[model samples]
Target chain A: MKRYTVTIGDITHVVDLQPLNDAEHYRVWVDGQVYDVALSEAPDHEPQVHPHPSTEAIPSASPAAARDRPADTATEPADLRAPMPGVILEVNVEPGAEVQRGDQVLVLEAMKMKNAIRSPRSGIVAEVLVRPGQSVNYDEPLLRYRQG
Target chain B: MNLLDTLLAGLLSLSWGQVVMMGIGGLLIYLAIAKEYEPVLLLPIGAGAILANLPLSPLVGDDGLLTILYNAGVGNEMFPLLIFVGIGAMTDFGPLLEQPHMLLMGAAGQFGIFGTLFLALLLGFDINEAASIGIIGAIDGPTSIYVSNQLAPHLLGPIAVVAYSYMSLVPIIQPPIMRALVSRRQRLIRMPYSQRPVSRRTRILFPIIVTAVVGLLVPMAIPLIGMLMLGNLMKEAGVVERLVGASSNEIANAVTLFLGLAIGATMRAEAFLRPQTLLILLLGIFAFGLDTAAGLVFARLLRWVVRGPLNPLIGAAGISAFPMAARVVQRVAQEEDFENFLLMHAMGANTAGQIASVVAGGVVLALFAAR
Candidate 1:
């Protein structure tokens, strides 16, 4: 479940969306009221709304989201963690560096293959805990963040 | 005079074929040592090939060591079955268990095996040999060995080398096809790892149930799946650390040497340098690319309908290369949008491919065993 503060005009609503079996359907709570929603690709003129009111998907209350925002830009904590065990090949982000979701923050070498760990959200890096050539374990936190 | 003549015979009896094969052996060793490609198996295989091709080498006759290992393990398919246990103990099905629907993509990955078989038949290979060559697309070395040795023992040398080499080349082979087939938007799609934890009881029962079910469905696969699940059962059972350690580490290491050497011994110039070997090599890469393509197309079809969290990149990993295929998929996705993490989802598809490939191998045997 993800919580989003959605604003339409002057009225702001706190909405929580929970996915059902598929990405299209969701059980959502809007300002404490619950509704079941199913999302589908809409024709050009139609709005992208589903089980919840078409008001929210992006986690932040700010208007940084776009009209073309993807449905999966689900809010997550800004801090990034190593997805698997590996050695840090490089660090691309430092504390106070502004980053977008999907920006490569570091490269990790695992099983002789290199993987880049990307920022989970558009946030300011608070701290980087690892350095190049340092071996790390699975789920070990690699970075801390302040939300953008 | 006879004793002096016999001593000089070894120096005089060199053939162009033996010389060429020895060079090939050197290449294999260079690949293993310098390129770091599946060294544990390839190094022994390279050495065995060199030993087998030595002028009047004693290690390759009826009473010879290499021949003995070949007869004992590879000829009868003992080594592959043993290796399957090791592979099972090493694989963790947690991600696959977390998401079960990925099995469909796994099934889709086998289309290449059949596709290659048809192409090989058209190119004049007998049906059984074609099937053995096709199994290289399965991308699991031991299964490739088991199926090929069972179906076309003569083709085992080329098939083994091709399978291992292509398995190593997966990252390169898959990315272009994946990029071509899946759109950028689809590649950038995110699939967070599922949080649902599989229960300990479910983990333990998983191997047992899979063995019984897969065994009954394709009884010929019983040998492959049974041993695989047995090793999996040991790992999940939690009471068999010693057993799991031996199966996954020491025993696997030992059998890999015997298997590699035995397989290499079969690569006598007379066997390994056929025109058909070239065809098998071509068909192996073709089949691998086809499997990746088929998987991507299948997943795209799924996304068209269900429409959520279905990253087509995960489809590329729907092959038996295990975590390697999955890792490649993850890397590709991250290349497009660093924030999108598809590793867990790709792993689900990869592990599914592993099981499906084994089952497909059994199906092949069941169909052609009578021939």
Candidate 2:
């Protein structure tokens, strides 16, 4: 059995597929509900193994060596997404600006109608990814925010 | 004494039918002012009805201003076409472009026009007359006038009034049918919004291409579609802002006043009180309901094939009431789910309905002319 995830609209569901003896029929479970889906292509299941030897034998004697490890990061990045596709007529917030919920962040012009994009939550603006007069695709991130 | 007695006797000779018509006119005025249903049109219509029905009013006589306005605009098919220019300028085709598939819904909605035509034919109207009456189902005023002017001029006044009246009632009439046809689950389906930016070049090319394609296919549609596309072209070209503004605002308002009054004046008691006029009204409602049902059913079929959030109610906005029907769809969707915003998608289908109604009008003319 193999598992896959599918997202439709805004809802996500995990699906499981089990191969049947007939080779054409696959038993699929979507969000715990089973469905019969046919396979149109052969499944690929081979896993590739890396052949590099370990390099941990070289020991470091420096006192600050433990602090140089890369995997101990604590902060999660903020996600900022565009509400609709349109030319970014203006960006009202800049990096490090503290914003409250419902603050106007950008203006999007679609179908000749101007729409003001507002902040979903309060935070400090961390980065602005677009500029004025730039056309943006739907759902493209226009800016990111982090805790002040 | 002899001359004064004769004049008084003439004034008293007015019939009860005319008096009743005057009262109906007053009622129309009240509805226009108090109820505020299409005040731009209904006010003038009500006023004209009152003036024309007065015992000795000269407003509807051969040389009167009302009659002259009628001859200048309605008789020559000038007002409706000019109004089309305004409609063309005001409409935005972005929604329709985002979902080209919704064009089919517009086509399905037009079943109302044909369905009403068939029913009118069965009710003893000749083919030409039936076509004009049937066009009232399009829920479009210009198309109604255009087709009726070409096919059956006599039915124009009643059909236009019926079409506009039913369009105003779309919010009331459409909800029941929409509720009955769609389930709660269907209404709650939230479609993810996906759209590609339509280039300015494409926007400029659209009106020209549509004019050529539709006009070549149905030459009879040239006047209605031609004027309509011309207005749209002016707006989209970006250089004719003045023309677009004038056509959408000044010309449209002026023509609406004249068109409404002219249509109202035609409702003289003797001409409008016939059983046939009542039948036209009833059939008009049937046509609108049928159009809405057809669009809903078609949308359901599309839903089966496509996995997304498409509210079936948006299909009902596929009539030519423009943003009004679209707004009604948004309201209905909000009732079902407060956060669901179906306005953009519904506007797309609504604009398609406007164009489709014009094509359907042309098709009707071509079909009749061929026979």
Candidate 3:
């Protein structure tokens, strides 16, 4: 068994790893907590697991829950998310507004400094979810663009 | 009758010069309390100045508070080095490591130190004195005090004042120079921040490598650079959070109070009232302006050589003033084009300048120490 310390954010966890019978699996002890984890061949190649046909009959209305309902909702990738936590100082785009890639979508004020959040791709603004003076957290979707 | 006579004698002993010196102290206190100009140092220094010059005050006499503090640290170069530990603990070198080319701007920023040294030499100051005075261009308080105390102990008060005053005035002094050198078009150039994640291993190694390299090259700089890098290493190791907090906050604060008071006590009228003091003040400003201009000019030259969106304004951030220099660069760029965010790039250059300034200080010591 080999010990390694990993820090996630402000917390540090000391992990002890011991290889099992197979080369691909290991028994890990993290801060006295035990977990059995398997090493994957291709970590970046995410296997798409399709849902049951009966579950796909009615699509979930919430777009944010992509992990739970990945069939139809995950395909809509035009949502521009806030890159950092800040107050929305200004919303430069409105609903139905045409925008190009690299266009300034909104202004965010964090730590008394202003940052310009730009659009990811060219599309029509289908919805502006954030308003001026509204605070937003990191990775929170600020606006959605209509599919071409 | 004897008590009344003693009171009269004490009142009579107070000179016009002492009164003026006390007023200067009051002004410094007012600036610290009211204007908030470097309150940590200025407050103690101001109070020390008052105590040192008072009629028969025991604060600065033999074995007094101010005298003992001066002997304990400022005189022997302990305070500044201790303060360096705090500075290192507080500084994040991630930006500088991400972009190593910013090191050139840091080196270029030291032009003012040499330029001012030459000017001071011409103005009748000795080579040692001139070099100490020139280090005010470093835009670093502890480094300035450390170098000047060693080279020219008499000129410590004026040099420290000039270094800090200009450091606080970074926003005001640097903007005009930046605008003058880089046109609105160049300032508007958006250098997109490429997030090159620095590994934890690299962060841990950085301070160690820097210390060995700098120490081997310029042995005189070992004290300042070594302490600084030691603080940085502890911060990156992640095992010493309590030590880091204490070094950056508590120790730094305590040292600042003592260092400031000791430096202030040295400013008695006999030593401080010379015509050379005024000259040093002017030369100090001249050196700072030269450093800024040199950094801007060097950045413009780099833009010509490098094929990319380079904002020459960020070059001005290559002084040792830390985050302030970077912030000024960002503000200047934003004024011309709000969409342009040069803060990350400026920070890279700013941190690079911090290391470069220490190196320059070491180089200065080497040059003088050889003689």
Ten-residue stretch with the least lDDT total in model 1 chain B: B186-195
The DockQ figures for the candidates are: 0.12, 0.08, 0.02
TM-score of every model versus the real structure: 0.81, 0.75, 0.76
The deviation in Å at residue B364 for candidate 1 is 0.5
Candidate 2 residues B108-178, lDDT tens each? 87989999899999999999988988888788988898888779877776787788778778888898888
In model 1, the runs with Cα more than 4 Å from the true position are A1-56, A59-115, A120-124, A127-143, A146-148, B1-4
- Model 1 - which docking category? incorrect
Poorly placed runs, candidate 2 (over 4 Å): A1-148, B6-10, B307-309, B369-371
Winner on lDDT between 1 and 2 is 1
Model 3 local distance difference test score: 0.80
Fraction of true contacts retained by every candidate, in order, equals: 0.17, 0.12, 0.00
On residues B275-317, what C-alpha lDDT tens digit does candidate 3 reach at each position? 9989988998898899999999999999877765578887898
Cα lDDT tens digits, model 1, B147-202, are: 99989988999999899888888988999999999876567565544346689999
Instruction: Evaluate chain B of model 2: give its TM-score.
Output: 0.96
DockQ of prediction 2: 0.08
